[model samples]
Target: MFLISDMLVRIVPLCLYSHTGYYARFFTYNVIGGIAWVAVCVFGGFWFGNIPIVKNNFELVILIIIFVSVLPVVFHLFKRRSENKIITKPLAEVVEERAN
Candidate 1:
């Protein structure tokens, strides 16, 4: 289940991007959601270990958590920073052009 969710989380973004150019929010949402997922996974693992059923799935759960959480946040942050940097220089140029 966790693996499936991770795959879906990844594929959905690609699918959205292919279908639409304006799905940038997915990046932001993915970052935020991924953080939340990691928090839950780390803490939940600790808590769930107290329960037998949850403990049995610990490895799978951790793998999914890392995949779903770490990947999206890291990818999105890099993408956002790179894009913003590209725009900043152009934006300054436009401002200078307008001022003159």
Candidate 2:
């Protein structure tokens, strides 16, 4: 909670400060990350409590939190990449047409 919350506090406002609609984007993304963190923590705690390898409870919790934080960021990046691909395809085709 603390790590995510700290990131939210820093990122959300910074994004907002840059432009108008950034506040909305910031809130929406932070909420999504928050929800994912909650879900992962709940499931990990209940399912893996007795795993001997992750014996220390705190370490297990931190690992779960980091995973939650990272996974969503990766997903977001992948989505951005796909969106960029969609945008660039038409522009590339136009440039090719001009070249021809």
Candidate 3:
């Protein structure tokens, strides 16, 4: 799931760079970055998994971790929605206001 999300985040930049003829550099950097990312994730999980609390309550810990991670995304979505509502004006209202 993390890898999929990471790939999704990279897709836009990859497409842009590829279109602009930087595919080779992008590919090289992406490979190196991907390896480092995987290594860190694996090592971090291995280190964390050895904790007695985590091992005892693995499921609860993962659920809490997931919920915590999702909080920022939820907050961002709500914030963006509020900003859009505040900034957006109806076209007819805009035109009428402009004419006045």
**Which model scores highest in TM-score?**
3
Model 3 agreement with the true structure over 1-100: per-residue lDDT tens digits = 7899999886988889889999999899999999999999999999999999999999999999999999999998999998877537888998999999
List candidate 1 segments past 4 Å from native. 1-9, 50-100
lDDT of 1 by residue, 14-62 (tens): 7877589756876777789989999999998678787876677878867
In angstroms, the error of model 1 at 40 is: 0.7
Ten contiguous residues minimizing lDDT sum, candidate 1: 83-92
lDDT per residue as tens, model 2, 10-100: 8867666567757667778779998999999999777776676656676777888799989988998999998876444677888998899
Range of the 10 consecutive residues with the lowest summed lDDT in candidate 3: 82-91
> Sorted on lDDT, highest at the top, how do the candidates line up?
3, 1, 2
Q: Model 2: which residue pairs collide?
A: none
Which residue segments of model 3 deviate by more than 4 Å?
A: 1-8, 73-100
Residue 71 error for model 2, in Å? 24
* Alpha-carbon RMSD, candidate 2: 12.0
Among the numbered candidates, top lDDT falls to 3
